[model samples]
Target: MPVTLAIAGLLFATGSNSARTDVDGGRQEELSGLVSQENRKVDAYDQQVERMQREVDRASRARARNDKVAARAQERSDELGRTVGLGPATGTGVRVTLDDAPRTEIGEGNIPPDYLVVHQQDVQAVVNAMWAGGATAVQVMDQRLISTSAVRCVGNTLLLNGRVYSPPFAVTAVGPTDRIAGSLEREPGIRVYKQYVKTYGLGYEVERLTEVTVPGYRGTLDLQFAESGR
Candidate 1:
């Protein structure tokens, strides 16, 4: 009779545990669904914000153009004041170049494979440092910089302002060269990069340019936002 009771007890315990696990799993599924729904709502809100900003920019530009035309027609003196001579300008700033480090021999496990390659974050860090050092304008490659532009990397190529570029990226900033250069030198990640430059032939340079002109941002600003129903 004692043995029979033991078997019955074991069966009851096993069944109870199985029921509890099923209940917990169902609750987890419900919670996951709620989180996903919340994320969707947040993403929608961000899209709306970007759309509104574009609309504002477009309206501002239109008003400025109309004002210019009216002033040119009605007031000769005002038009003359608005017109300024376009002249060659020069700025003294620093140029920084970043390239992939040289590959190491695979015989020893001394170095990881990722160590020899350049990353997008590395480029971003340098650019951020320059901006923090009071850079007025910054340019990457042949394209001019803009406030809305984003720099991204896929594999070894960089994507900036709807253009693709290969490595050995050059970033130029118009600012106080001394302060910009100092910022780069003082960054923590740069120390690791210096090691790469010494171990492998990573291309790096900081040169002060006598003249550089960063053009203004040129792109269409279109706005799209969620209407009441849509």
Candidate 2:
């Protein structure tokens, strides 16, 4: 069941992966171009949001007509921003990093080739468990998760949102460090992956952090479509 959760399927998936790089030649170039474009768009959106927030702060400070009201409004806005991962977050937490095993003969006895490398589900397993454990926010690779975020695999690389990242995938969470670690240990899916960790040396590491910061999500929040509940 743990392994099952890790490999859960959904729509919009691409080809599965082995240890080999999936993006190659023209295809790689095309994906690179798209990733670059998406990164720029995310940057632009972050800048615009920052600009608007600064303006709002200035306006709020200048208006003395309702000082208390303005302060409360700004407080609520900031709280909601953090809740939605739109505000930078720093706190005590745990960091779990996963990497593909070295290409070697160790643990190659009966394990399949596919188990040697990290998959989207492996990363997703750790992430989903941390959240279930009360993670305030989580960062995968270099991007913070939003409700609409998706994790997929195109070969051995991770396609998150619109970016491609190679492991070791570092998943950091801001919350009670003990609870986070315990959650990963108790998560059936993560436990299944950990079995491979012992068998094939697939990377699964945990470090407790007294202070770590997860940046606010920078991608567009607008939904492109939604399934009809027919």
Q: Which number leads on TM-score?
A: 2
Using Cα atoms with residue i matched to residue i, what is each candidate's TM-score against the true structure? Answer: 0.55, 0.70
For 59-168, candidate 1 gives per-residue lDDT tens digits of 65566577987445435533432232111224777788998764444223576645666677778877887887777677777555555556776555565543445678
**lDDT (C-alpha) at residue 72 in model 1:** 51
Q: Give the clashing residue pairs of candidate 2, or none.
A: 2-188, 2-189
| Top candidate when judged by lDDT against the true structure | 2
- Global lDDT of each candidate: 0.62, 0.75
Q: Write the per-residue lDDT of candidate 2 for residues 1-230, one digit (tens) a residue.
A: 22112222211222322223645455545545555565566556567877886787688767634687777777887688777898888899989999999868435767676888898788889998899888999999888998878777756777665555677889999999989888999988888998998887898899999999999887657774478898
- Poorly placed runs, candidate 2 (over 4 Å): 1-76, 105-111, 228-230
